[model samples]
Target chain A: MELREMSRLLYQIKLADQRVATSFERETGFSLTRYEMLMIVNDKGVCSQSEIQQEMKIDNAAITRHLKILEEKGHVQRERNVANNREVFVRLTETAARELQHCEQNHDQTNHLIAKVLSESEMQQLSALLQKLNTI
Target chain B: MELREMSRLLYQIKLADQRVATSFERETGFSLTRYEMLMIVNDKGVCSQSEIQQEMKIDNAAITRHLKILEEKGHVQRERNVANNREVFVRLTETAARELQHCEQNHDQTNHLIAKVLSESEMQQLSALLQKLNTI
Candidate 1:
């Protein structure tokens, strides 16, 4: 593709992504990153901070900062591993699990609202195209 | 589309956008938002901060924060209008103009690298799909 066309494509991707993310945050009251972090913790039952960092592809400092806020909000608890004092493990609180269930419902609605624009075939084509583009 | 498929598509779009943005920043030493802000300043010659906030669709505090960083880095200047002290006008500096030109070149290279994976038809298809999706 030519430079201008390529730039326009990238711009469109950004705008669409932003629209979806904004709707998600508005509907669910959680940023997608934080929601994903909670999902990771919930999925693993209990996982190391490093594991969450790796899964999320975020740096240690960012992970720590996010965990701190989650902890403060009573959504998660962090504890040092007794077997490995330097390692911190995180898990969701009962409150978080309950709240996450509600968020999941809202997440579905937000996703539906955004994704309803394209037909099923167009959705598949977009998905396939994004898969190819992301391989870069 | 099913909720699962819709969620997956949103996730893919987010991932692809992040990949492109990360590469752009790494290659050009400028975030896409900051680059776009500079482009706006260059395009307008001199414009009010509110005008920029409107054009960019960002909150006033965010525009102020970004402009502060840009001003500190010698890329932009903000001055209060004498006739209307509440209004702040912004324009690019000579240094910023020169640097922005170089950044534009790097941006083209970055776009080329990411976009070269898709064929011309795929590129066109993806752009049209994203345009439709963004209408949400």
Candidate 2:
């Protein structure tokens, strides 16, 4: 409620973000953006760019740029849709799949550090609260 | 927790970050990092780079670079310590004070969006959880 409390909240959010970015990079030698995009592609099996944009609530242009980078990194493959020339389909590459597996192995360690102080119930409460906060 | 839940959590965190960044830039024409550093300097009265680094959990070099930009932007002023030349003290300029005041006013609207679904208790719980998480 107070400005000081709000400042602390914002600072913690920043710290958590840095921690995640650093951890992901240190463990997998890839940026968080690359990891996230690969995970999304892996989850969807194969998805169009528009689907990724919609699901991520990101702009189409940003998605396009990131996909291009991911493609160059060999983390994902983007193919022109034959039926719809404008559409591009994306899926994870074999190398990306291996990196994602490594990511999962490292994720547990990071998650444990994040939730070290909170009990199971507290973490559940926190997660539920965050989910509520996340709803637009 | 499942990978799906973890992915969703990370996604929401990213969305929250994007929302804050967009809102701050739109409302104040300043980036989040700039705003945060300004706010920190304002809070500290006269803070050293080491102090800022400690408080924000950021590296000293990054703090120095941001402070240089903030100095150029006229949001803060830095002076070498009279007794210890290596130490630099930073404080907000009058312009920054005005901007911070504007930030507080705009902050409510952004905060409302972020916590729209959270009850007061939930917000408190979330804050407490985050505080604990920040210790690491």
Off by over 4 Å in 1: A1-15, A102-111, A120-124, A128-136, B1-15, B77-86, B102-111, B120-124
Clashing pairs in 1: none
Tell me, by TM-score, which candidate is best. Answer: 2
Leading candidate by lDDT: 1
Query: What TM-score, over all chains together, does every model reach?
Result: 0.74, 0.80
Sort candidate 2 into its docking category: acceptable
Clashing pairs in 2: none
Candidate 1 docks with a DockQ of 0.43
Model 2: DockQ against the native? Answer: 0.40
Model 2 chain A is weakest, by summed lDDT over 10 consecutive residues, at A2-11
- Best candidate according to DockQ: 1
Residue-wise C-alpha lDDT for candidate 2, range A39-73, written one tens digit per residue: 77898999999898877777888899999988887
Worst 10 residues of 1 chain A by lDDT: A1-10
